[model samples]
Target: METVEFYNGNKMPVVGLGTFRVENNDDCKEAVKHAIINGYRSIDTAMIYDNESKVGEGIAEGLAEAGIARNELFITSKLWLADYGRENVQAAYETSLKKLGLDYLDLYLMHWPGLDEAVMIDTWQGMEDLYKDDKVKNIGVSNFTVSHLEALLAQVSIKPVINQVEFHPYLVQDELRRYLEVQNIVAESWSPLMNAQILDDEVVKAVAEEVGKTPAQVIIRWNIENNVVVIPKSITPSRIDENLDVFNFSLTTAQIEKLNALNEDKRIGPNPDEFSGQ
Candidate 1:
């Protein structure tokens, strides 16, 4: 699997398994195990997802089945909006660790920058403390706008290593991407395939046909070509394997620009600035 290094020098696989709506415990567990068995080393989960225990089970099963040590896997979990206080954030991390059945996470992210800027700042300080205390390998934020990042950066003692957001051909987020680039922070894409909706886009379809690949593969490769981390979720074994098969072909600069021009700044998920703790 291809990898990228965090600001702290920790290596993370560029492509990971995203566990968002894999709600059934057994299904999520099996999906994670299958993903690991098929060579995936990175797994992304969150507190709000409420499947950390199942993910933990899958990790244990995958480790045993693959005969790989725990340290070889890059596991990530997020802190939810309700758990934004300094002390509450630590408790949230502990809860996730317990559910994940791990001593420390490879990456821990703030799920959202709540409406209150002060709360978000406090939550980040708590995350910084966790990193200093060796509870997590790297710290980051999700769904943060450029303005939010600028404010947070002004108050932070430790800069975030990443800013994960809804990224794809349609919602490219160029401004945020540029800011992250200047800050030396990596941009991670949560819905690289636009929840599988991009598979039918004319641009994606044409590129897939020209490249002799699936639309999913083309989209995933687009993220790779742009140096962005991608996590495409799937519980089906074949689809999981297909998502990981994006390393063979490369897109040309012109083709990449063609894909880049398809951006509309559209979003299928909730906006961070107005989220009300869902």
Candidate 2:
């Protein structure tokens, strides 16, 4: 698996399994285990997803079966909106850690920017504490815009290594991407397939046909070429394996342009500015 290195010199797999709405414990566990056994090295989940224990179970089973150590994988989880205060942050991290059956996390992110600047700063300070104390290998944020990031940056002692957001051909977020590159922050794509809505678009389909790969593969490759870390969610074993089968092919310049041209600034997820923990 290819990795994108953080400014801190830590590496994360560019492709990983996302467990967002996979609420069924049994199914979620199986999918995680299957992903690891199939060569995946990163796994993303969040407190809001409510499946950390099952993910932990799958992690243990997968590690034992795959003969890989715990440190060989990159596991990520987020601090939910309800856990936004400085005081709440430590307990939240510990709760997530205990539930996941792990001593430390590879990456921990503030799930959303929420509505209050003071609260966001307080929450981030807590995350900075975690990083300084060696409780987590890296720290980042999700659903953060340039304005939100600027505000946070003004008060933070440790800069976020990543800003994970909804990214795809339609919602290219060109300005934000440029800003992140300037700030040396990695961009991670949540809902990279736009929840499967973009799979059948004419341009995506055409590219898939030309490359002789599935539409899903075409979109994943598009994200890869754009230097975005994509975590495409899937509970099906075959889809999980197929999602990782994107490293071999490279999209041509014209093909990449066609995909980039599909950008309509469309967003399938909530706007970070207005979300306010809704």
Candidate 3:
């Protein structure tokens, strides 16, 4: 799998396994192990996902089974809203580190903007401190809008290395993508498969047929071609293998244009502006 060059100079895999709904220890551990054995180099998890411990165990198992070094994998976790305060941020991050059983994290992020601008700044200071201390190699944000990023960037000494949000062909975030590119922050796609809705779309189907691949592969390839890191979550072994099969093909310019034309600005996640920073 290919990797993206992050602001911290670390290489993050372009494709990863997103353990969003892998709740139980058994399922989460096995799914992650299977993913690594099948050639995944990155695994994204968060406190909100509630499976960090299991994920850590799976990493251990995969490492022992595959005999890969620790630094060869890129692991990312996010700080939850409850831990957004200055006092709580550092402690919460430590807890996450302990749970993940890692010497250092590849990336750590503010899951959402804190309730107050001051706290957001404070929490980011803690993140900056962690980065300096070598606890985490990179610091970033998730679900942040352009204004939100601008707000934090204006106050903080260190800019975020990445901003992860919902991105797919139908929910193309052109303006935000352009802004982030200008800022030199990479955009990570949380739901790059369009919730499987586009798997049956006529345009995607046509593209899939032309490429001799499934619609999901077409979409994943599109995301990578767009320079966006993608993590498509699936517990099923077959689906997981299918999702990572995107590296074999490339999307055409006109086909990419057709996919771009399918944009409807749809978002499955909630709007951040109306969030009141909570």
Scored by Cα lDDT, where does model 1 land?
Answer: 0.93
- In model 1, what are the clashing residue pairs, if there are any? none
lDDT of 3: 0.87
- The models' CA-based lDDT, in order, is 0.93, 0.94, 0.87
Can you tell me which runs of candidate 1 are displaced by over 4 Å? Answer: none
Off by over 4 Å in 2: none
Compared with the true structure, the alpha-carbon lDDT of candidate 2 equals 0.94
Which stretches of candidate 3 lie above 4 Å from their native place? 276-278
- Please provide, for model 3 over 257-278, each residue's C-alpha lDDT reduced to its tens digit, 9 standing for 90 to 100: 8998899998887776655434
Leading candidate by lDDT: 2
Candidate 2 weakest lDDT stretch, 10 residues: 269-278
User: Model 2, 86-189: lDDT tens per residue?
Assistant: 88888999999999999999999999999899999999999998889898999999999999999988888899999999999999999999999999999999
Q: Give the TM-score of candidate 2.
A: 0.99
CA RMSD for every model?
0.8, 0.7, 1.4
TM values, all candidates: 0.98, 0.99, 0.96
Better model by lDDT: candidate 1 vs candidate 2: 2
